[model samples]
Target: MALMRMAVAAVVLLDLGIRSTDLEAHYTNLGVLPLHVLFERAWNPYEFSIHNMSGLWQVQALLFLAAAGFAVGLLLGWRTRLMTVLSWVMLVSLQNRNPMIAQGGDDLLRMLLFWGIFLPWGRVWSKDAEGQPAPASYTHFSAATVAYVVQIALVYVCTAFLKNAPEWTTEGTAIYYALSLDQVLMPGGRLLYPHFELMRWLTHLTYYTELLLPVLLFIPVGTAFFRTVFVVVLFSFHIGISLTLFVGLFFVINFASLMGLLPAPVLNWLERKLGPATQRCAGYLGGLRQRLPAWQLPLQVQATWRPRARKPGYALLPMLRETVLYVLVGYTIWWNLDGIIAPKYTMSEPLRWFGYQFRTDQHWGMFAPAVFKDDGWYIIEGNAANGRLYDLYRNGRPVSYEKPYSVMALHKNDRWRKYSENYLFVDNSWMRPYYCNYMLRLWHLNPRNPPLKRLDVVYMKEVSLPNYQVSEPKREVLCSCEY
Candidate 1:
């Protein structure tokens, strides 16, 4: 127990130390005022605009300082409940203020911190009590521990299920898309663009591993070995993402979530360290009692010599109920295999066309009638004016041409325009704007011959475009142009 406590303490100390420098930088850059601007004015969930107190800098700063103080108090176990609430408020404010800079980690950390409030974490290893006997009931610790574990597992499982796409599995092109500028990888990621084959194999392996990780949790034969491997792979994956992607602080938050995996022994040791002072105080009270007269002893003390009643074991029904609950949970997971393994992919021919058109930004325009061959669709792009058109193959063949109105009508009926408009100015709007803007810019650059019209016919083929680049047009124009 003592060794476990020491290990836990060491881990906590190390985590705190590593985070300190980054935390200071985060505080300095964000501060209090900017956060207030976000919370008091920005729209809920979609912080698109600011509404009030646009320039009241001092007030914002004060609020920020108060929030920071509260967070520190919560972490140190001082007035923890109040501090926890304040910390959550402050954390949300900070995140909302600069949503662009926030990452997945901040969200995860805030959730974990919220759970911490319900635990008796402060009763031991805190300044309020240098030595104290920690609470024996496992109520708080057990619940929080379980919640953290479940949440972490869900995160991985959900992500794995979401990535079970044709591009991810069959073509292995998901990593290529992720590393592309269209995603959020580092600027120099193009250096690895040539190694698509390697990336494809790696992507498949990653997908398989993530999908199988949850099942590995319940297996006992080599559980520790599996856990170590899982941790190492996940940590390494996160490190790569942090170094090569612009996901902000998501990795940090995930690392913190792993703290729940620590053995229970560490917590017990911390309780012992907190007991010495409590024992001394108990001794002092005992001495005071010794000095009292014999008649002054409380009736409860005299009665203590009687045998105490023992609690009965749980009834058969209650035990059976718990067993049933465990079985149900396992069954629920197994029954949802469709949601877990086979996500909504293009199951039919018509659906495949809709899927391709839907995936591409052509929801409203005419789509060329193309057959879904073995290796995806075949498509083309053409330039009519100069009779200079490039053959665009998607997977490896030529694609049939569809009318512009057909594609446009589909997009309009499906409410794609609304979807695009919402994201261009709302949350989860990350890469959508860049893609839209690039297309619009391309059209504007060739204004007189608007590339869309000039491309009289496009033959769709699946061919990789190497060093493909699009330049911004000097003139700005509305994207909605009449054909």
Candidate 2:
């Protein structure tokens, strides 16, 4: 649990740092969704966000910095419970503020933080460890234990079940299609794309692994072995995915979640192997804990740090805790199941109400059943006041190539790439206006550029795949907007 906490917190910090570069563009009112409109349309009374309190970009930057602090506090186990809550709030708020960029990784990170709040993640390798009683040899059975295991398993199982598309199961071309797409593909994808047959076989292996491996989590016998195997296999899977896709933090977050599933025996063996070094590290951390200011010291101190023995808590404490745990566990199960059998097994209104209130509602059908077939690039044409046409994106360059050189680095993050995907279809007319205006705004903001009177959204589609042959670009005007 401690290792999991540290890993998750580390990922949180890394994610925040990456996002900090585009804090204003991604998290402020000036981004995709303005704060006032979002508050009106999607705000829940139960949810609170500091990110929404101001429209100033500086405020968002401050909030981002504060979130980074909370993540560090979580990693160090300083005021751990409070830090966990704060970290979860900031994560949810930032993601909700501009949901356009959020992906499966963000969802997984949020859920892990939610569940981490209920576990004793600060029990070891933390500054709080200096003033505490020792724990039992094995982790005891509790609602939290069950919930954590079940939640992880549910994500894998739900995804496996939702992959009913023939591309994944029958044709075994899911990975081929995934890699061939220009948007999410990394340079590694270009190198690997030619091996279509290997990708097909790997696709089948991925499906079965996702489907069957989760079952091993529930087996009581050889729990350590099963969990160890699960962690290694899933970690490797995520690493491979990371190598080929520009999926922002998704792979990292999933790798962190695997740390939580590692059994106690494995941790114990690790501790034994690292014995003297572990003690030295703990002592170093203890010394640092002592140097903390008076105000901060209390946060790192254990709940029972006094010299005198304290009376046990009232009988109702355990009962109350158990009640809350069971309630949350039941809701977690229903929430995941509903997502798996969506449209067929919808959650009851009350369940949904609670889910929205907690911001815990989730779906796990990642790249399920079918991968997108349409591969295209956006061509933004600007008609300047000087009666000259310009490619607003590439500084007046013509859109001749099937793939943009910038596609390799065009998207700020995966969310941008995913958002671009929505504009590919003719039915997604909603994107045209926003995209057109966005292009116009960019052109107008550039002092060196000529003023544009109008902008047009054009798409050039790639009709051939599985073979790298280029077809004549099928160009179509998606929409045009006056600047």
Candidate 3:
């Protein structure tokens, strides 16, 4: 649990760091999707974002800094419960600020924080522990524990059911389709792309693994062995995914989730193996800890010390936790089922308001049904005031129609990649002109740069054909903007 806390806090910090680079444009009203536009077209009535309270990038910076501080408190387990709630609140608010940048990994991360709020994960290896030794046994059972286990399992089970396509099942060509896209293909995927038989086998393996691995966690007998097996297999599975795809934070969050379920025996073995190294690092961190002041939250909750009879309401806390856990777990399962089941079985839009309100709404449909066929690259065509053409996507370079060396590198990060994908859809056509203008504004930020007369967001569209066939990319201008 301590390890999971540290891992989650670290990932939250990393997420904030990556997102801070795009602070103004992505989170503020001055950027592409202005607050007015978001409220008009995308915002939900129940959703709350402190980020929307101000349009200034300076305000966003302050929020980012505050979130980082809470995350650091979470990492150290200082006032663990309060820190967990604060961190989760900050994360949910940031995610609510922009929906376009979100993906399945973000959903999993938020859920981890949510479940962490209900667990006693700070009893050991935390500042709150104050040098108390590690727990004799690392296992515990509670309503929160059951809720967490179910949450992780539901991710894979729902995704697998959603992928009821022939390519994923008997046809066994899903990996081929996934790797065919030059935009997301990594070196490992490219190396394995040529082997049709291997890809077919991997496709089958992936489907079954997602479908079956979670079942191992629920077996009542030999729980330790079953959990060990699940962790080892899923760890390797995510490693393969990281090597073959550019799924930012997806594997990291999964690794953190799995860390919580590791049995005490396996943890003991690892502790013995790495004790010396851990001690050395600990000494270094200990020295740093002394140099730094202790973290204190701005507001602290005061407990009543008056000598009063134990109240019945106080005694109901455990039952309350259990009731809340079961209710939430059931709701989450229903939410996942609604996404995977037939339309008639799904919940109505009004019924799903709670999920969106709390940001528990998730879609794990990654490469589902069938792999995406429309794979392509973008070209930010800019016409300079000097009558020269520059590819602003390449930072105002000489216009070149040739394909980039790595299409994946064209995206600054996973959020940008997600936004780009959304930009391609006709449903999101309202976003294109704003994005074109954003690129134009970005390119002219430097006074010495050549001014742009106009900008065009062009996509070199190529549809991946099965059986090793390739189609020529057709130039499609998605948006054209002039100053």
> In terms of lDDT, which candidate is strongest?
3
Window of ten residues with lowest summed lDDT in model 3: 292-301
**lDDT against true structure, model 1:** 0.42
Query: Which lDDT value does model 3 have at 477?
Result: 96
lDDT of 2: 0.76
What clash pairs does model 3 have?
none
lDDT for 132 (candidate 1): 32
Cα lDDT of model 3 by residue, 309-417, tens digit: 8787886988887998899898888899985677898888888888988887887898998899999999999988889999978877888888787999899998899
lDDT by residue (tens digit), candidate 1, 323-407? 6544433432333233445555313343334212211101101000111121111123433344444322221122234322222
Candidate with the larger lDDT of 1 and 2: 2
Which has the higher lDDT value, candidate number 1 or candidate number 3? Answer: 3
TM-score of each: 0.48, 0.86, 0.93
Error in Å for residue 415 of model 1: 29
Scored against the true structure, residue 59 in model 2 reaches a CA lDDT of: 94
Instruction: Encode model 2's per-residue lDDT on 13-84: one tens digit a residue.
Output: 998888887765556666545677567655676666778888788999889989999999999998888999
